[model samples]
Target: MRCPYCGSLDTQVKDSRPTEDSSAIRRRRVCPDCGGRFTTFERVQLRELTVVKRSGRRTPFDRDKLARSIEVALRKRPVEPERVERLINGVVRQLESQGEGEITSEEIGSLVMEALKALDDVAYVRFASVYRNFTEAREFSALLDEISGDGREAAVDEAGGERD
Candidate 1:
């Protein structure tokens, strides 16, 4: 690796370790000529994936774009950065595991909905409002009812008793 301090081509790795999240490898390097030290991180790029939009347009799958949307939904919530990273990783893994060159936007939205649901009910509702394109109060009420388990309780009451 080139030395950042002097732009020298003679740099040696002094130490290497995996980052806390295990998403990348951190390397400590030294420039022999200038005796300068610096750090660098390396991460693996598995493969390129494409997102097929609802309007039949295709674009490269962007992790940052996905993370930004989740962050917007999670704004002001008491969620940790680590948890958010894990959530994003989970969604990426799910998409990668599909092994398809292109995936539908609906599928991606469903994955995000599941992730947000497990993370926070409020965030889930927030994301669902935009993702599902809610226009009326009834739609929002239905989502709240579903998340609050009211729908399930009502179904059980209508059935006359709890399951044996």
Candidate 2:
């Protein structure tokens, strides 16, 4: 590891352990040349991801951005914070496990929509409105109808009974 203080390439790791969430490893390091100590956190990344935009522009995948979008959709909602974390983690894991270096923005949007759909109806509709670019009242009505139908079907299936 490179020392942040002296810009030295030689740094000795003194301690390493998994973080509380086990999402990353915390490492303590010291630079021999400058006698500087610093901490670093690292995570196991299967591969770096590039997001391919519909406009033919490519950008690096950002987990924070994804979280922010989800937060925006879930804003002022009654969902628990822990469930939100799990939802974000689940989406990220699905992306990483795809084993592809490049993913489309549409694919990411779809994944978030699915996660939100299972978590909260309001949040799901909130996200879908923006994701699907609803430009008219009819569009909103169509989406609401689709959502209601899906909910009824899910309820019937979960009850182990035929749909009435």
Candidate 3:
């Protein structure tokens, strides 16, 4: 690596360690010419994925855009930041695992909906409303009904018996 301070080509790695999250490697380097030291981080980049819009336009997949959408839906919710990070990472992993060079916008929206649904019902509904383009009150009510029904079934299953 080139030395940042002295603009020299000779630099030696003094130390290397994994970052706190273990998602990247941090390297401490020193320039032999100027005796200057600096740090650099290295991260693995998966293959670039393309996003195919509804209008048939293809664009490079943007992780920040995906995270912003999820954050907007999760705003004011009781969820933790770590959970949000994990959700984003999970979605990205799932997309990458598909091994497709391109994925439709609809597919991404569906994945977000599924992740939000498991994270928070209110957030899920919020995202679904925008994602599904819900215009009628009945659409929301129907979704809420479905969510409530699922909750009831889960409760019943956990209780190990039907309601008396």
Best by lDDT: 2
Residue pairs clashing in model 3 are none
Model 2 per-residue lDDT tens digits across residues 1-164 = 88999999999999999866677689999999999999997877778999999888999999889999999999999998878877887888899999899999989999999999999999998998888776666566666766888553222121223233
Each model's number of backbone clashes? 0, 0, 0
Candidate 2, run of 10 with poorest lDDT:
153-162
lDDT of each: 0.84, 0.85, 0.83
| lDDT value for model 3 | 0.83
Q: How does each model score on TM-score?
A: 0.73, 0.70, 0.70
Per-residue lDDT tens digits for candidate 1, residues 10-118, read 8999999987689779999999999999999786656788999988999999888999999999999999998998898889988988888789988999899999999
Candidate 3 to truth, TM: 0.70
Model 3 misplaced stretches (Cα beyond 4 Å): 1-21, 24-43, 150-164
| CA deviation > 4 Å runs, candidate 2 | 1-21, 25-42, 150-164
For model 3, residues 22-141, the per-residue Cα lDDT tens digits are 666899999999999999877565778999998899999988899999999999999998788778877888888898989999899889989999999999989988887776676676
